[model samples]
Target: MPNLLRKSFNVVNRVRHTASVAGLSALRVAKGERPDAVMLRETFEQLGTTYIKIGQFIASTPSLFPRDYVIAFQGCLDQTTPLPYSYIEQVLKEELLTEGQSLEDLFSKIDKEPLASASIAQVHAATLPDGREVVLKVQKPDVEVIMQTDLGVLHGVTKLMEKLMPQMRFASISPIIDEIRIRMMAETDFIAEASNIRDFQQFLQMTGNTKVVAPEVVEELTTKRVLTMSRLHGISMVDEVAMRQYCDDPAQVMADTLNTWFASLMFCNSFHADLHAGNLMLLKDGRIGFIDFGIVGKLAPESWQACMGMMQALQDNDYVTMASCMVDMGMTHERDKVDQAQLAGDLAKMITRIMAEDKTYTSGKPFNSKEQADELNKMMLEIVEVGKRHGIHFPRDFALLTKQMLYFDRFMRTLAPDMDMFSDARVSLLGSDFKQ
Candidate 1:
């Protein structure tokens, strides 16, 4: 009971601090003194890991955040002060000694410094006793406890925001918080991540695609809190200049990456939800290395079938079927007085405009001009606005799909300027029928 009270007090204090800072920041922006992205980045860094992870989440989900905030938070770095070596030793000793093995029994040597430190865990470089190089991802002590406290505070804040700003259509905060909680819990379990790695490896093998690589999980060396995996060396896929220097066909690399993701949606039961440049790499052997399978989305067999139906309907210009399929997928609310026909018409009109834009830009012109990108963003915003007016709430899974497509869009603009993503034979969401 005392512990619970302390945790509740901590949550309340944190929420108050966050509210104060946000209020001051809003006031500054209102006075025309907008906070610099660097300042915001620093603020998150000082605020600790949960906020840093939230910033990273905001950076990844552009559809859910304001443009300026998303762009600003993208610069938020995840560098954390390393826990002491004594703490690391203690954790390893506690977690590894149960099976009659000590830290030295498994690893020939463990580095005192970590390779990377984020919100929940830190990665350290190590070498197995069998002479294999590996990276050890160790979870922080009592991370779950801290996360629960922080998330509770976050929920409280979200409630306050909804009550204060009733005009803002901010979606249900509870569901969003629950989703975050679930994903974070999954991330905290190294065993689950190892399973994701193995599943992705099997997926790559089954697809007969040797161009993509998933890291090999070292099962013998893995535990619930600790994961050992093969270390990969490569340049980020987003580094166009570096990738160009390494590969003769960066365009093909981009295409293969997109196709790999598409195949995951069609074949694999689970797909990587986060595919930012940091998580994608152009390996030395020309294979695309996909890392960080912490956040993933799974479509049930029924859901996948429904998605395929919706895609086909969109391709064939069947507005009624598309709207019905969307409703089946729970994208809109079921109100007794809702006008299904009007909703279908609105959806169809919106799809027509989007398809017309693709038709007009079939040449696949370079997206170098800020004006062109801004126009595209404005079109997307307008679509979101229309959907909101119809009481249609886009699910997070849809947002994840759209986010991956946007990455493909940017990559295509840079690599294959002559290839239209919507009209190209290479990009097919509904398989061969939708191929250009």
Candidate 2:
């Protein structure tokens, strides 16, 4: 009976949310706005959580969505207004309370004001009874219910649209809806995120790497909805001036980051997938701190071996080997359809043209200019296009990998202007002997 009541409440809440979204969109239309991708993205951001995840999905998935929509949803904000403290306290009480223990029994201090707020969770700076500084990551009230309900609503809508409108079939809306459900559900599971952090920490320890770290999860204080982690003090990696206070050379930080990340591709259970500026930091202790393990990517062993091969090939300017490794990394419905030689020739031409047009690489300078960045993006996209032409479709993990590599490229341009990413002696591609 309780479960049924909860389900009913969730449906009612979803209905109200749908009505609100419709009303807001209608008002915008009445103001003489056409229903374009930008407007839709705005609507998604305003809707929060599930919709924002969908928008991000669109942004990350160039192979699945159109160019204009993908471009518009780039860097879609995950931020939202902070929920009230009363609600947060209530969740803590419910999730952490025991037979005789109270809030005071657990924490010495939990700040009412949030340090940061996002669509799904709010972070508060806190102190343990033993005087340890930590952060409380509390999920918004009913966020799980809301996300599940919204996904159901979106799934149904997508199915209906696909049946009624043939033109919508190309977007593969239903599959996207399914993928969003999996990702959003995982995000809501703080326990899983905590486990990811632990796994990464283990990876670091095993590799004898002390230059990089992730926040330590306070297991006793953590739950599926709320995560408690040791607080880290640092400056964002991109802020080179602020970083100089702790580290002499910020470029070394980037090198440590690159090496650690590349090693994780073959050695760790999963690699950090969403490592944007916000998630990476140069700690006051002169270490690179990787935080927010909410999203991770696990490549198959065979796929990773191929990825290593591809990287080595790139360094050697061996486009033929790179093309073959790409075939191994990506999936295809029709294996016989792929023409390896043709794909190799296309890749060779693409890289040559890009290098010639950009001149950044040959000029021995940082790829800082917008034109250089665009050329890099074009090269990645053209690689994908070439793969598609040969009937190969890169997996979601490949997209995540590519996106992080691009982010690292930006970081390199800022911190290590003269460094060559492909041949940098400090960066490790896990070497030829690395095996999972």
Model 2 ranges off by over 4 Å: 1-7, 23-34, 165-171, 308-319, 345-366, 431-436
Best by lDDT: 2
TM-score of model 1 vs. true structure: 0.76
Per-residue lDDT, model 2, residue 355, is 81
List CA RMSD, all candidates.
5.3, 2.9
Instruction: Quantify all predictions' global Cα lDDT against the true fold.
Output: 0.71, 0.83
Q: What is the C-alpha local distance difference test score of candidate 1?
A: 0.71
Candidate 1 per-residue lDDT over residues 21-134, each given as its tens digit: 777667777898757765676666667767777777766555456666666776677666778778777877877776766787888988999877777888888888888888
lDDT of 1 at 48: 72
Q: What would the C-alpha RMSD of candidate 1 be, to one decimal place?
A: 5.3
Top-scoring candidate (TM-score): 2
